[model samples]
Target: DQQVKQNSPSLSVQEGRISILNCDYTNSMFDYFLWYKKYPAEGPTFLISISSIKDKNEDGRFTVFLNKSAKHLSLHIVPSQPGDSAVYFCAASRTMEYGNKLVFGAGTILRVKS
Candidate 1:
């Protein structure tokens, strides 16, 4: 079965603190990893991504690290802001899938206290 798992359903933190979300995968064939963020009724927006060729990737306030041997990945947000309170989904795919189809986790809801 090709699936990604996010064990935590939610996380809460005060602003200006660090937030970490974890994910695990069962498929060793997966080569592409992504983190998506969503608000209310809106669709997920890509926050950051990494290729299996690399161990880590970073964006402005976000970072994603992939550990191929462990079949795990994580997203880190530093100095978390109130606006970061939302649902975060960890997604992964196999490159052979062609169009980068995503297998998303149930999503972790983050609450950033002001």
Candidate 2:
């Protein structure tokens, strides 16, 4: 079974609107949660992150929320622009014997219309 899941396969929004992406996890051992944005022919770039201890974290137009109790997280983008169109991924990591290993969910493609 997949530890991380993104039920929605895609999302669409108009420019200057809000875009919300949701994710769920089955692992309680995951302490760090992150969101990454990926473009075609490129790797995913780190976006926003939240620790299990924190309920929310924000940076500029991006915000990430974590609900430890529910094992859920969500990423929100405000004033979504056309350039924001890309695949968004949710990742979780836990400190292991060797190092931190990340488990990623299937990405959600976001389409931002101008």
Best by lDDT: 2
Superposed model 1: Cα runs more than 4 Å off: none
Q: Taking the tens digit of each residue's C-alpha lDDT, what string does model 1 give over 12-78?
A: 9999999999999998888899999999989999899999999999888898999998999999999
Cα deviation at 61, candidate 2, in Å, is 0.2
What TM-score fits each model? 0.95, 0.96
C-alpha displacement of 59 in model 2, angstroms? Answer: 0.3
Q: List the residue pairs that clash in candidate 2.
A: none
Considering only N, C-alpha and C atoms within 3 Å, which residue pairs clash in candidate 1?
Answer: none
How would you encode candidate 2's per-residue C-alpha lDDT over 1-114 as one tens digit per residue? 999999999998999999999999998989899999999999999998888889999999999989898999999999899999999999999866324578999999999999
Candidate 2 global lDDT: 0.93
Candidate 2 to native Cα RMSD, angstroms: 1.1
